[model samples]
Target: MDVPEEHSYERVKYIPQNFFETICNDNPDDFETELKKVIFSHVDASEKLGQKSLEELIDYKSQVLLKDITLFQNEGGILNKDIIDLEKKRTATYRKSIEEGLSNKKLELANHQSNKPKDVAKLESNGDYQKSIDEEIKYKRAEKEKLEEELNLATKKKSEQKIKQSNLERISQAIDTFQSQYEKLKTDNEPFLKTIGFKFEDAVQVHIDKNAINTLVETVKIKIETLSDSIKPDNENGLAFKIIKLGEEITNLQSKLDEPTKRYQTYLDDISKWEQREQELIGAEDIELTLKYYEGVLIYLDNELENDLAYKREQRKGVVSQLHEKKRAILEVYKELYKPVTGFLEQYKNINKDYEITFDVSFRLKDFEEKFLNYVNQGVKGTFYGNKEGTVTLKQIILETDFNTLEGVIEFFDKIIICLERDRRPGQGNESREIQSQIKNGFYLDMYNLIFNLDYLVPYYELKLGGKSILQLSPGEKGALLLIFYLILDQDDIPLIIDQPEENLDNQSVYNILVPFIKHAKSNRQIIIVTHNPNIAVVCDAEQIIHVSISKTQDNEMSINSGAIENPSINSSIVQILEGTMPAFEKRELKYTLTKNNMHSIPV
Candidate 1:
């Protein structure tokens, strides 16, 4: 819709159809698909509008898609039996083919059974011949040799036994002669044995002594009975009990010692296990502590450095402003200076007599005046000048002299920032410098702020990247700024909440900036952006949407209905905007519209 250039720009609005038609619209399925396509288009457009980035655009597009998809389904778009039947037919065909293939493979395998390898035959015939011939001959030969050696050794041992028997007979004769002497020797040795308390015939007398010992035993038994009669029963019983108790005490002590030995072994094993566990825990603890400390230090340094950098930025902004003012003053002074020359050139041109000379004078004076003015406007930066009739041209002035002063001023300001950063860095001797990280954190956050509030922020970040102070932002820069304002109004448990965050953003910035921001917000938070950008709504999660439809009732009165559908994900603010504008949007013919006609109006 083209409009008069002189008139303010207005976004087109969407109007819902009447209730009866909406509830009974023909081609409801097609409408849903078309609406889905529209939502995706919006998302695509949002993405290309880079100010908002992909994340934000996706969020907005998701919401729009959800609303349209849901509405389409709620209006009676359903799964068709024809499609289901077709799918089942395809599945059956696939299954039949697979079964046929399996059957053919089984038949082929059965036919190929004879091709299977049989076990390799062993040389049983060779084994039978070897066993019956060579093995039998070798065994008989070995047995005969073994028997021959044994027979020879037995014959030799028999001869040696006979020789030993002959020597024994000679010794027996010598022993007979010594027998008589033995008796006398024994008689002499008997007296000595008695003196030494040993008898030569004690071995023979042992049995005889045993009988005498038995007689003594009987005599001792009689004496024991007499002693028992003399002693008191009470004393004997007490002595016996004391002896038994002592024996039991000794036995209990021995058992107690063994228990300590077992416990000591168990204690040693436990200590060894505990020590191993302790080592493992200690190692883990060290790593965990190191990570925590490093992370903590990084966070602290980031905050501190950012604070300092922000202060430095403020200081630089003050300096940049002063420099700008100085530059402006210089320009103003140059303008005033050149104004006199311009007046002279015009006066001289009017007074010239000769046509050619007059033209030359006019041109020379104009060139000089223009050149001087250009130089003055550029803060007296030196420039080239073309001379003719004692005057220079503006174009010529710009090509000759290099204005080093302005460059020097710019370089000086840049150095000031560099010096500030260098000073903020930790001492060279110290290893804990986080100045660089802090600077990055500060820059990233600042960049985020600009992205969120593109109406003001985009240009701000651009300026910073361009080596300009934040305070020196132009009006255009402010226009491109974007901001993401997050407010946790309540911390209590709740299922979902919708917010109209785009109310603060501009229409042009909305697609590239606000929509993406909304989408980003919704990605992390369950939000519904009431946007006309169908692109954003289409890609959103389908389960979270609640579609609200507006239509005229049978009585010709406007009405609204809400329902669930295939896609349920939507930003609540978008829903609210649509719901609120339902009546008004009914009068309007478009299928979509912004909430308020006012350019900067936000939801209340």
Candidate 2:
């Protein structure tokens, strides 16, 4: 059966009283007849199954229309019936205006014809009068030709004036743009100049020559005037040619201005580099003094000829005391920072039962101590302490280890001090060798300094989930987990439209896990799912179903049928198409089994 067009039908539950009252206000008999004709013309026997006669069908259609109109009024604040009435009034008013205009034109034409001269035949019969009339006609024709020539010349002059006015406006706009750019350039560069310790005015003068800019502007003005004067009314090139040439000159001037701006940027970059170099030089001076002081103390400890050993030992003890205090402070800070990581791991373990995860933060001092001692033990007795034996093994020096106590961290620093003092003995000629090169190139003292620097050396926090890092999870598992996390944590009262949430999920997972979650979630928010899955529609007990079908007619025009499941025909079609013919009958039998008989004679 062919369905009626969607536009001609409205799905409404009830009709309002105002609709009937309005219909009755008009000719009730004619209105009912017309409404019945419209209803019968579109609806077929299938659609009229529940109705008995034409009047009942008309009443049903009227209820639908009245419900639609009421909905329209509620949404758009304008009644459909009132709109129709206004449109009728408007059409009548327009028709009356056109009729009145036509009548006035006809009356005026009749009066004009009555007032015209009726002596044309008499004038034609008299030869003298005819000759005089012909002469008057010739004179008028000559005067008209002269006036036409003057009008053509005036129009040409007006057109030329318009072209000149447009060119002037373009020039004015270009000047305004140039002025704005100049002011913005100056403002943008002011802060950069101040940052680099140059006066803004001085930098502007040095980089952007004002005199040159003024000269360029003046030259452009002269060129504009020269081109304007050269524009002739009959010139084939036209004003467009002059305007293009003006634009080219302005572009050239802009290119010239760009050079100074580029130079200013270069100057700012150079200043920044020089300031960084100055900071490096200051740091180098402090490092030089520190190395010299350390060298002097080592020399005092080594010699018994120049100084008392007790005084040197006392000074060394004082330095060691301070180093111990710094070590304690570093360990305290590391423990405090490690608390958050432990708390997060505890929470993660509680939530994710299937995954076994562990996290720990501890200082890596034992690792550094082992590496440093290995380097010292492998060193030769002479030749700058390691020049003969070569350098320490890189793999050995970069080991990862954790320490539980502050005493272990302190003991690690003591080993590093002993190694450095032994390398700097007086007879070894170590003072002549660059201290930085010796430390960095051979044993990598910078690595040791990094370990010593409290800000640089913090505790390492390691994480593992299900005996494997999170990065080790397969891509599909990761995607599923991320989706589950978002759904569980980020609940909000917004409609979530998920297209095929069961795409990669197994059938069991959809029926047991996803369906229940969606059912619970729908209680708090609306969800619109577009799917081909029958379980999602039937098992979820969806409140409304829009069964949509597309087909093409013989004319090759596309037709779309969309209706709600509340309609028995639509509901049956959805079941037949989505769940197969057998399931549809099973559903029907479940509903009407008690009243039905066995159909043994019916063919499958």
Candidate 3:
């Protein structure tokens, strides 16, 4: 059954990789339905048949419903216009909202300007001023200064008292130091009570046991008496002179002993009196004097403290009173300022509540209205005319609708169109050549979309390797493209053999799409390809190779013989060979096949 040629230019239904799954579910019960009913039915069926594989069922369903696989239609191409229309409407809506927001801001600013002076007056210098209050504040500050001076005077008095107390303490310490030193020296040189002479106790004890000193004293006294009596009896004789001399010497000795005894007794009595006085002072007098001195100082300090403390209390009371007055003045001023503003601002706030209505309701409504109009216009254009050229120009609508930013939109799309046009005609001088180049480029781009964009090779739920882009295709995509390439190359449906089909592919990506590749294309298709890598060759069967070569003739010339190698080993050939003349080899196939032949019938 041939398709009508007039209908050839009509939009072709692009069967997306997921079309089978979508359609089978959509038409599960009936092959055709009302347009609306069909859409609902498809949506419903996809949801219902959650676990079933649509790709698996597509083959059977295609046979039953659509007789020809290539003749089937897809709804996505027709939906592109609707998508573009909806996007335009949405964009207009956004733009309208932005315009509304700007208008609201402008309205807010205008309201703010109207109320600016009132707000400033509420906070101005004279707004809360009172002459009496200022005078009272000045008076209170003067009072506070007077009180501060009094406090300073009291502090000075307290400092003087502290200094006097420190002096008294130093005097008491000096007296204690003298007393301790005198006591320590007196103890080291103490006099004995029993001894008449100034002798240490150990020296006196040594003489007491021996009577050497007493015997000497007694012998001297006896001699002195005898001399005295002899001197009286023999006054007329020569012995009288000797007696008189002895008498004078005895008197002199008596005088010396008498003075020393009296002095020694006096020293002993004085020492006893001094020791008794020291004990009396330590027991009562010392404590009494010390207590009396400190008590006097403390009394003097208390007197000074009483004066200073009284002065400080008086000053603090005045200061506190002044602080209260100042605080009252400040509060009065605050009341004056706040009282007026509170009423004025309360009303102002109520009036301005909508003034600050941040939402640009006016502009927003305007924008939405404009957007709605544009959307309606675009919908009409899309639904009825299927044209966007001039049925309702956005510029005319923008100018008449008074939109501020429609020009920006026009400019943006204009730039995009310009860029597309430039890209379309890149890298050429002549217009036709440029157009041809662009067509070629478009074909290349379409090839990218067709092979890579078809996501059945990477189903949504299935796992996929990372870093996958059209530019970075997995081996499976490349192989599929190669299959497509070969299919296009051999439009007559001849079998194809591709060597090293996936030479530079990553392993994980290859594994992820291998199943899809086999299922979609390789499973039902006849393809033969060679690979040095075992990934492809290991999986393949039924391969043949022909190795051929040419050698110099025995008479210094060359000959050719070439034939198919029935079974070629991985390393070398055994079964068959090729023989041929020396020829120019340009491509991989040529490099592989072209060779010179020798005179002998040995295959090259």
Candidate 2 residue-wise lDDT, 26-139, digit = tens:
444443343334334334457664776655643554553444433332322222223223322223344455455445544554564454433222123235644454444335
Candidate 3 per-residue lDDT, tens place, 297-374, comes to 344344554455345434433333333333333333323322322342233233223211110101111232232223
Residues 317-428, candidate 1, lDDT per residue (tens digit)? 4444443333334334323323333343344332212210100100011133332332232221122112331133333333342222334334533442343223322333
Q: Each prediction's TM-score against the native?
A: 0.16, 0.25, 0.16
Clashing pairs in 2: none
State residue 528's C-alpha deviation in candidate 2, in Å: 2.7
Model 3 stretches astray by more than 4 angstroms? 1-492, 506-525, 543-604
Q: Which ten residues in a row have the lowest lDDT in candidate 1?
A: 355-364
Instruction: Assess each prediction's global lDDT (C-alpha) against the native.
Output: 0.35, 0.45, 0.34
Ranking by lDDT: 2, 1, 3
Q: Comparing candidate 1 with candidate 2, which one achieves the higher lDDT? A: 2
Q: Given candidate 2, what's the lDDT at residue 543? A: 70
Where does candidate 1 stray beyond 4 Å? 1-520, 552-558, 567-604
Please give the distance, in angstroms, between residue 26's alpha carbon in candidate 1 and its true position after superposition: 44
